[model samples]
Target chain A: MFETLSNVFTDNPLIVSFAIIGITMYIAYKLSDKLTRGRIHGSAIAIILGLVLAYLGGVLTGGEKGLSDISIFAGIGLMGGGMLRDFAIVATAFGASFDEIKKAGMSGVSALFIGVLLSYVVGVAVALSFGYTDAVSLTTIGGGTATYIVGPVTGAAIGASSEVITISIAAGLVKSILTMIGTPFVAKYIGLNNPRSAMVYGGLMGTTSGVAGGLAATDPKLVPYGAVTATFYTGLGCLMVPSVLFLMTRAIFG
Target chain B: MVIFGVALLAICMLIGIFFGEILGLFLGVEANVGGVGIAMIMLVLIVDYLKKRGKLSLPAQDGLGFWSAMYIPIVIAMSANQNVAGALDGGPLAIMAGVAAALIGWLFVPLLSKGGLQTEETVEENTFIGGENKNVRNIK
Candidate 1:
């Protein structure tokens, strides 16, 4: 009877994947609410947990697909594939409101542009100093500075090596974590007291999870405004990084 | 009725991906560019248009809500798919680049916020209501 039930679950890999994610989310949120008192958002905590699991899976299986390398967890490969990841991200825009977006105005718009550019510049300089002189690597890593999602997307689109793409992702993850932890500490000093400033902050920060989590800590009220612009920032980064930015990097580095 | 929302999302996604691929082709890139982002923009636009037309029903809204709620889980899965261990093996360059970008971005916050158009008093009331209502609805 136990073997039959286990076989049934293993046969339906996606279902098993969902169950694992569900349990992970439950634990992550519980940790957020009880342990951290919601100072850190559940999503950030979940990502950390997921990363740890991935690391462990890599060690245990000595395989590339992380936890999915284990047969029972094979569904994780499909669940975490690009298709579903893209679908979930696309679905998030449903919650956005045009009326709310209009409130941010010109400053918010310019902040997005400036934010992407500044991050790219900083990322490129760091990449160069680290002796990664190739245009593809520089552009991909620069895009990663914009956001983790952008990093991988740009890298793949421009045919960058898998190693470079992974590094780019790691770079983006570090940015997201820092943004989450650093927001509240610097909020008052930066005049992040109002919705407008929050919107500008979001546009500048560009990482949605980071901005959302940080704003939640600083002022729960500011999260929405920051989130809206941060979403736009991601979209803008996605559109810009692989095309125009890649061209620029090629021009300079070549 | 909830299926209608899913259908709508599917239609928008198809169109978005098509355009994204076209954009990629134009730019000479092999991979799809901004497909997900484009789909998101389309969903937002389409939903807003439907809402304004009063064509969106409660069930359809529920469908959107269901998927929106799935956001955290999907993000977790995506993060899990990343090769963090491999990235770490490449050394501290990745970590340095990320920290530098974040810090420099933070340093510019005050400069960007200095000359904003709206005063806090006038913009406060309307934005507060909109922001709070959104938070309640999304719950993320």
Candidate 2:
């Protein structure tokens, strides 16, 4: 069943997304309490949306041309899957968890600022000794993972990485840092104040993000949902995005 | 916040290009989206509009409410297009442009949020996930 579903979606994601959406809306309609409603509804949107994207992209992918024909949809689907997953998390999390995550997410902002500041400071110091004026790429090249995660907005804003590569790295790293930073805060704020106890929650959320990030990072169909979460709401679906993936893998293959 | 979302989107994309294939392979799962669309949306909507209003920060009971709000636009949008990308692409060129617009939102979001009354009213808060919301059940 699991393998079959995966093959189905893998073979045709658009059809799968449509199927999932149908099932999901039904689930949403039938779900009783708010908690359950939030989780099911949030996840339903992501999975279905993912299916829609993959299916459409598959039209291009499954054709004679592979990804190139489908590249546009491929890009869209790969991006969509991740976006939907984020939406699931934030929407499911809703107001309460959304705020908590937001508060904690600021840590990523701080790291982004620090990384940029230090990277340039050191870059210029070395550049002066070298007698070169083009030290600006210091922020670009030096802007590694966090900066990339934060994106070129800051890179461009700070003039860190006008070039695409540096901007990408700068944004990516910042998000990773933010994710890493968020877990600990989630632990501390969520009740496990003790470092050891907190680490347990932190570790769990951290691991979840890694998996979720990985899943989201690859799937384009889910991008819209991820965009929803990353942009506006709570990440309660954060934990669920991965869980659903696990569930989907199991349901489809098992 | 919108600024942060854009950065995350770009980073996630880079990661998708590099590590995403590997991780997705190991995980035996599709690992695709990676938050780009969210960044697009954030850019379009602005962070302050995207998120729930932050008041005392103790906690919010409106988790379900928030989800309901988010679900509306997305579900409707998804239904309209058999292909999500096709639908988004069909929309205004601004969305298709991605990060450029998100930059615009980040620059101006605070201003949008600030336009409303500054004093926040006290609202009910939901502290736990299922912990406190056990009464809550799935929409199914």
Candidate 3:
């Protein structure tokens, strides 16, 4: 019976992958509720757990792609691929009513541009301080400050070195983790208790997972509102960073 | 109803992917254009329109809700698989740039959060019908 069950899971990798994720999420949420008193979002804990598992998988298998390196966990790679990632992102809009969006008004609209430009400028300045003068590298790293998705997307578009692209991703990831952990701590201080404020905050932050996780921890009601604008922030970043931002960086540095 | 909602979502996704490809071609980028974003917009508009018209049932709305929130944890996990190890090897400068962005971005929170009250109606609405009483579970 044990051999047959193992064979079943091994044959249907996706099922086992789902089972692992399900169990992990259950434990993560339970820990969040009990240990942190729901201060740290379950999603955040789950992500950390996933990363740790991936690291261990890499060490044990001596392969890249982490857990997917193990044959049984291969489904994780597909499940987390661009297709589902994009789908999940897009699905966020379903909960966002246009009427509620209009309620956010012009402040929400400007927040997106302000957030992107601000992050990009900071990213460029930091890159410069670190002695990177090339236009491609500067723009890519700057885009990373905008969001993790934007970082890799912009880097690939501008043909940055793999090392630089990886750095850009790291920069974005750092921003994401910070946003995830910090939002709850600062929610009360920033008055992020309402949907409108959440929408504006999301626009300013631009990291979907961070905003969602942060808002989930702060107030689950705010997650959809924040996720909506964060999604827009990503689309806007992808649209602008490679074109307008890249040109500006080149004109300045080259 | 659930099946119908799922079908709608799939259709919107396909169209969004197609539109994104066209957009990428036009922009001369190798990446897919805002396919997911566009699809999401379409789904929202269509689903809401149907809901407002009383065509969508409660069960269908619930089904959409379940699917929408289902993948979030998985997505978060997938994102962790990014080439963080490679980025760490990009030297101290790269690490500094990343750390600086995160810190500076955090600083912006205070400044960005002060957008202020827009209209009297919104404040009233939030206090009366919004605020803590408005649950995320009932968003659909």
| Predicted structure with the largest TM-score when compared to the true one | 3
The ten-residue window of minimal lDDT in model 1 chain B covers B128-137
Candidate 3, pairs of clashing residues: none
Error of 2 at A21 (Å): 11
- For model 1 the local lDDT of residue A37 reads 92
* Highest lDDT against the true fold, candidate: 1
Residue range B5-99, candidate 2, lDDT tens digits? 33433443444334434543454433322232233333223323444354212222243333323333333222222332322332222121222
**In model 1, where do residues sit more than 4 Å from their true spots?**
A1-6, A102-112, A131-254, B113-140
Residue ranges of candidate 3 with Cα displaced over 4 Å: A1-6, A58-64, A148-159, B79-91, B113-140
Error of 3 at B68 (Å): 2.7
Report the C-alpha lDDT of model 1 over A82-178, residue by residue, as the tens digit. 6765565555567654454565557778989999988888888999998999999999999887887888889888899988888888788778767
Candidate 3 lDDT over A5-114, as tens digits, reads 76886788767777788888788888888898876767667766776776676676766566777776777776665666666655556665566666774666777888
A166, model 3: CA deviation in Å? 3.2
What DockQ number belongs to candidate 3?
0.34
Question: What does candidate 1's lDDT look like per residue over B1-140, in tens digits?
Answer: 98887778778778877887887677655445545556766777788888878888878876766665565566567556555565455468788987898888788888877754345555445432211235333224
Clashing pairs in 1: none
